[model samples]
Target: MKLPEINTATPYAGLSPDLVLDAVSHCGLWPDGRLLALNSYENRVWQVGLEETAPVIAKFYRPGRWSDAAIEEEHAFALELAAAELPVVAPLVFDGQTLRQHEGFRYALTPRRGGRAPSLESTTQLEWLGRLIARIHSVGSRQPFVHRGRVDRATLMQAPMQAVLASTLLPASLQANYRSAAQRLDDAVAMRLEAIGPVRQLRLHGDCHPGNVLWTDEGPHFVDLDDARMGPAVQDLWMLAGDERALNALLDGYTQMREFDDTERALIPALRAMRQMHYAGWIAARWHDPAFPAAFPFAAESRWWEQHIADLHELADGL
Candidate 1:
């Protein structure tokens, strides 16, 4: 089922303050009219205050971005990880449903989890995160998502490259340059993946960047499984590893719970290149959304595009 496209410039225009309060109330929660917008561009997330209870997080899924089944699958994966005693924030089930709709919006409520960013410089922290991720993957490997996507050249690079090319955000004068650089990077990534051959693909947190990890005195807990999908285990590992030392630290903890595939290490550069291309393409595709331009003002600058093209070539050359 497709949701009606609202104003392209502000897709969440209809998601007004009143609508959010009412949506939370519909789920049997008493929102105290206090709403704080979270840092999210892909979805409209809010910290809704309650009268007698602590604040709860309300995440309104981006319209038309994912099918109901795909969203439900993500919710299920989060729940599975949480159930396995992993540090994950799963959507709170309301009236036996994790995914709900109020008006035209599909939304979910999760208990608010607060913590600061994980310190990547701390080997102890990285090892703890490694263990957490390994445990999450242990559950992830047990089942495959039937509705979500997979991490691959098509989804991560090619389609996004097409989106960038179609977007008017990239200056027309630099379009040819951007395309050529993107294609070279794409080819390099493809060759690397082909050389790596088939590696074990499994369910992953998908976007395990440091921002998604909340570190506390206890250690770290992961948030945001929105990007969860089938992918190499390395996809989850590479983003968190900044260097060889960090990678070794992560693998040291990872092997405690699950076996690490040495072959997947070779896919890191390819994965990194795909992510770089995907990020630029994402901004281009979402340029119509006011949030994108406001959050990423540099993306509109020609210099940024030129630099991005140069970076793409550099990444390809490195591979």
Candidate 2:
């Protein structure tokens, strides 16, 4: 039987077990054939066991998503953080090269670091996380990315809104309403950002949610700098805190390590608004990919779109 051509857009479509093992072996490692897929939607990652050795992780980059320069910048940043004794899991340098190509897939290998989600309920944990993030930001401020992108309204809000509008997922009935709400919300977010004035932009772990952080007896270790980009320091700090008290605890720890710009606090609402629209747009853009629908079944439902529109309107009002 003949199979379909998955191509670049569907990079993981042809990633069979045999191909995965081959990719690992091509890296000069002996694969024991025990493979476990990790939780990652943007890229394909696996834990490959070795013969009489500790298992290592293999991450296959999504084709056409990032240029070689951008990916190299990310690798360099990870190595910088690691050199400072930070807990970031840097890619393994085999034959003096971290990035490698095998079977037409670009990939990197790393030692498998283990830990569970950090307990955000504890003040101590939150503070510790804050200090680590501040350290990260300090290093991030020392340099800038030439080939990498930046986190801004254009990529996070305007572009995403345009993509979602172009997608067929939005019901015709709610399409007009969504357009109006999204536009209004975009305007509101713009005004809010303007009020915050000129904030400093530093390289950040753009998607610094709880899932990217792992906790162990030692402390927190950040993983998946895949979304790393130039952005405000607050962008890394906001997602980890739920309330003012939590924010205070985090800032307290952060300030101890580095100066925290209090003015950046005002941009949180605007950032939140962008996140909502960006998420919807991300789902819409990737709807053609099989993983998206299974993960976001609600995107197909009209009711969900209605709620999303309503939520956008409410967020706009608050902003």
Best candidate per lDDT, number? 1
For model 1, name the residue pairs that clash. none
**RMSD each, Å:** 1.4, 2.7
lDDT of each: 0.91, 0.89
Return the clash pairs for model 2, or none.
Answer: none
Per-residue lDDT over 74-152 for candidate 2, one digit per residue giving the tens place of the 0 to 100 score? 9999999999888899999988888988767788999999999988888999999999999999999999988778877
Residue-wise C-alpha lDDT for candidate 1, range 248-302, written one tens digit per residue: 9999989988899899999999999999999998998898888888899998899
Give the RMSD in angstroms, all C-alphas superposed, for model 1. Answer: 1.4
TM-scores for candidates 1 onward, in order: 0.97, 0.96
- Name the top TM-score candidate: 1
CA error at residue 267 for candidate 1, angstroms: 0.5
| Candidate 2 Cα misplacement greater than 4 A, ranges | 1-6
- Residue 211 in model 1: shift from native, Å? 0.6
Error of 1 at 98 (Å): 0.8
